[model samples]
Target: MSDAHVSLRDVTKVFPAANGGEGLHALGPVDLDLGKGEFFAVVGPSGCGKSTLLEVIAGLTPASAGTVEFEGWRVDADIPDGIGVVFQEDACFPWLSVEQNIAFGLRKTALAADAKQRRVRDVIDLMGLGDFAKSYPAQLSGGMRQRVCIARTLVTQPRLILLDEPFGALDQQTRLLMGDEVLRLWRQTGATVFLITHALDEATMLADRIAVMSARPGRLIDVVQTNWPRERDSRIVERAEFGAITARLWKTLREESLKTMALKGAGQAAEPA
Candidate 1:
């Protein structure tokens, strides 16, 4: 639909095999629609092309077939200003301080210097980094570093934010805290959030809907909607309903994971579904 913030129809990706010829189909014939300002998650086994799906949506990589559109415009390598992306790694540059890194994306923009700096300060405050705005990445803890990365993306004022396993490197406690932080940011920003993660609990807690992908030649096998309130917290997992949702996610993922392992063992590509 035209109002969809993001859309992917029959999207697919393939890579040439190491020895050459025919190539390995890694993902798709996937169809997805992300509504304006919705929080969505994609989950699957390790080699199931979760990141590939995200990158295609981000315009970081081209889809081998089908279409990707954002706000009725077809997506290409040139991502529009309305999009922001955060990967699993802490992408903060060593030479840049917290505020400087957050403002980096605005470097080539036409915004006035003071206005650009104001945007950076706003995000730092919003992310609870007011104290560390002048500190370098080396001065922060892992969780704090990730917060800086997120602030950097937020400062860009993106309408659609894509995160690929953004908290995968954090400790369990920190991951929970970061997840809460992400939700708060989402509420404040009202961006369409698309997160990719292997943690079923994370998906259950943060996603309005979660799509489960099948084995490589990845296809979205199912999409599960949750009833979590818009204002989410880590404690949501304490609810019995949360456990049920996570259990269902695990059940869908396990079958695909076993199939992927078997195919890899036999030196064969997973058949496209």
Candidate 2:
């Protein structure tokens, strides 16, 4: 049996003329798929629409052309039911305790109170936030707060998780720890993860496959499989294989980044028509 989670076929996004001039081409005309239980990361130059792609797939933003599918159906702006999203911003609610935040996703459901408590408790322990279950977001450190954000998303047991730079604000060491946590959750829940990250090392370290994008009007330049041991830790950074993949990731990133900058420069230098 085949298990494809999210599929984008010739998906393109174009922003309408901002100052009544010309529209901006954002992402796609790119085709890609993230399989079930797969950890896929997208990396590209700034403004390459990495987050746009995630948004499109999540059905939060509409694509101008083509299709975004989840679990076999086209997800064209209606929020899909089985997908969980964690963004870069502070998602933890200041007023809610750790347990309360984690249970937020299930509030609409009719589950019995005891069942809800068990689900919340399980995710708290799963995320290693059991110790702080009673702590509020304001009382927690940055990393711990992010863990709460993630646990909140996971408590619903979504089949697919879309992470948009969920660890971008953290320090390098903290990001590594969070990457480990994400992998652990993926293992436990068997959820497909589609992540957008700018850090090449972070992408290389955490992704099962890395999708590299080009300049604006982002296209799938290539997809490289990590296949570097499923059970990984931050210590893997010291190994030679990690260096090899990360170096290659940088090579693609640098080339695409330069291309985008050059295009931007030329566009700015040209007089408006």
Candidate 3:
């Protein structure tokens, strides 16, 4: 991927053990490259270090080994300038209104007040939250709040956006609708999106390519290209190829999941009573 917006080479993360014995090996030895303006996603079983992978790419967490680079710059110890991260949990400021929360990240920028406001307004309209600009997190539904979170990230005009199951808490219908919103955002903003999700359908519908990982001590097992057009929406799921893509993702993921469950059972069986 010559136009790689984000690149990882042999990236791995291991959590130090409190007893100074062994560590919990979470991720990789994985190599991945996300192209500029591409919508890429990662899907894996629970505890497979999917979130760890996202955090490493975002520079929120350091990798024990290997390198992560974004847009030709090595990223270590600090988040790169052109990256934004949205996690599964709600991060909106409780005290701030929708507009204020969205503008919070821009405060430290060199842009003038009018410019900041304009950017915020543009994102608000993009996310379809114009009606709720005055509303707070408590006043919005789950899907709407997630949109607000994404809107906040978009206001900064990041070149790469990393989303960790941002729509995980929403209902199925809401998740599909929010997928459409994300598609619109991706098309309009032309930003590279790196999403980590457990939902095969969502990944199938939204991503240009989907990477599957093995169970903990996570490894990149496969990458499936959706082969959909850049200008696409949730309705594409109704197409035959959508089902085939989702099934392919599931096939690999299910194997990993079963292996994960067997490993967990074996671990429990070996534990002291």
Candidate 4:
């Protein structure tokens, strides 16, 4: 009866060293809820466990404690059909053409051949990768490769999409263009999106609501609502209200960023056999 599409009840994650040394407490006791079709953004400083949190939701990593539920069912294990993920890297297969890469996951499904082709074609056009549909991953530009990554995810038509800094490696101009493209895809597909990014401007530009996280052993600090119009453009960043919101978020994030830096320094000092 509840409509909560994704719920994290006090979820935590800790990574143990491969050599069985001390564990890294990444995130903890974080309670969050995401409604269906919501464009949610998580922003935090490096090592704040933003990416780890996303991996938890994607079922790529298990939580050290607490629970994660997707669409009312516990997500303690991988359920491939229910989720799609786009990482910061271009994860497309080098040997596969753009269309083949998009169709890779669909091969296991019961979808008709026409349906699969239609889905692949639709996302190719949606992502503006029409001309590059037959190209291998090695042939595309960085931005174009990322678009292929997105198209591969979208072609599967998963109910939830997790994006971990999908454009972080790109230049500012390409990132902005890709941001618009992502929004356009979300609008057309109506998929619930959870994106993790370090870029404040991208968060403000793309998210319906932004969840701010604290430094190491990450916790939700605040969930800021954007006052900008749903139909947003780069010009929205020029508004006084936009500046105000970013300023407040910066106030929250700056302290955490500095704290993380100090922790990193301490970590470096203590690193030894």
Q: Clash totals for all models, in order?
A: 0, 0, 0, 0
Q: What are the per-residue Cα lDDT tens digits for candidate 3 across 1-273? A: 656888999999999999997989999989999888999999999999999999998889999999998988888868888798887888889899999999997876789899999999998888889999999999998888888889889888998999999989889999999899889889888999999999999999999999999999999999998889988998998999998898888989999999999999999999999
State which candidate has the highest TM-score.
3
For model 1, the run of ten residues with the poorest summed lDDT: 264-273
User: What are the lDDT figures for the candidates, one per model?
Assistant: 0.90, 0.88, 0.91, 0.87
Model 1 has an lDDT value of 0.90
Top candidate (lDDT) = 3
Question: How well does candidate 4 match the true structure, expressed as C-alpha RMSD?
Answer: 1.7
lDDT of 2 by residue, 74-187 (tens): 898999888999999888989889888989989876899999999999888888887898989999988899889998898888999999999988998899888888887788
Q: Model 4 over residues 57-159: C-alpha lDDT tens digits?
A: 9999889999889999888857546699999987989999988998996877798899889888888888888898888989989999888888888878888
Error of 3 at 221 (Å): 0.6
TM-score for each model? 0.95, 0.93, 0.97, 0.95
Arrange candidates, best lDDT first.
3, 1, 2, 4
**Model 1 lDDT tens row, 1-273:** 767889899998998788888897989999999999899999998889999998888888888999999999999756666888998998889899988899997876789999998888888889999999899999999889888889888888989999999999999999998999889889989999999999999999999999999999899999999978898798999999999999999999999989988878776554454
Prediction RMSDs, each to the true structure: 3.3, 2.3, 1.2, 1.7
- Clashing residue pairs in candidate 4 (N, C-alpha, C atoms within 3 angstroms): none
